[model samples]
Target: MAAQQSQGIQTLLEAEKEAAKIVQQARQYRVQKLKDARSEASKEIEEYKKAKEQEFKAFEASHAGTTSTTQAALDKETDAKLKEIEALFQSKKKDVVNTLLQRATQVQPELNRNLKKLQA
Candidate 1:
C-alpha cells in the first residue's frame, strides 16, 4: 500500500509539471501575437501616409499651370497701370514747371512803414 501511495504522488507531480509547461507556452503565444499585430499596424500607417503624399503631389501638379498664368496676368495689369501713370506725369510736367517759374519771377515790392518814423 505504501508503494502504491508513492506512485500516486509521483503522478500528481508529473501532471503539475505538464500544466506549468502548457501555461508558459500560452503566455509566449500571446506575446508573439501582440508583436505581430503591432507590426501590421505600423505597415498600414506607413501606407496611408504615402498615399496621402501622392494625392497632395497630384493636386499641386494639376494647379501649377493655372498659378503661373494667373501670376502673368497680374504682372501685365501692373505694368499697364505703371505706363499710364508715367504718361500722365510726362503730360503734366511742363505745365507744372512753367507755373512754378512764373510765380518765382513775378515779385511785388513794398516800402517799410518804419521809414516814415525815421525821417520824422
Candidate 2:
C-alpha cells in the first residue's frame, strides 16, 4: 500500500508538470500571436499610406495640364486688361492734360462784395 501511495503521488506530480508546460506553451502562443498581429497591422498601415500617396500623385498628374492651362489663360486675360488700360490712358491723356492747363490758366478775378459794402 505504501508503494501504491508513492506511485499515485508521483503520477499527480507528473500531471502537474504537464499542466505547467501546457500553460507555458499557451502563454508563448499568445505572445507570438500578439507579435504577428502587430506586424500585420504595421504592414497594412504601410500599404494604406502607400496607396494614398499613389492616389495623390495620380491626382496631381491628372490636374497638371489643367493647372498650367488655367495659369496661361489668366496671364493672357491679365495682359489683355493691361493693354486695354494702357490704350484708354493714352486716349484720355491729351484731353486730361488740356483740361488741366485750361483750368490753371483761365482763373477769373472778382472784386470782394464786403470791400464794396465797407467803402459805401
For each candidate, give its TM-score against the true structure.
Answer: 0.64, 0.68
lDDT of 2 by residue, 1-120 (tens): 999999999999999999999999999999999999999999999999999999999999999999999999999999999999999999999999999999999989876999889989
- In candidate 1, residue 96 scores what lDDT? 100
Clashing pairs in 1: none
Where model 1 places Cα greater than 4 Å from the true spot, the runs are: 1-12, 94-120
Q: What lDDT does model 2 reach?
A: 0.99
Error of 1 at 90 (Å): 2.5
Misplaced by over 4 Å in model 2 are 1-12, 99-120
Candidate 1 residue 70 C-alpha distance from true site, Å = 1.3
Per model, how many backbone clashes are there? Answer: 0, 0
Model 1 clash tally?
A: 0
Under the 3 Å rule for N, CA and C atoms, how many clashes does model 2 have? 0
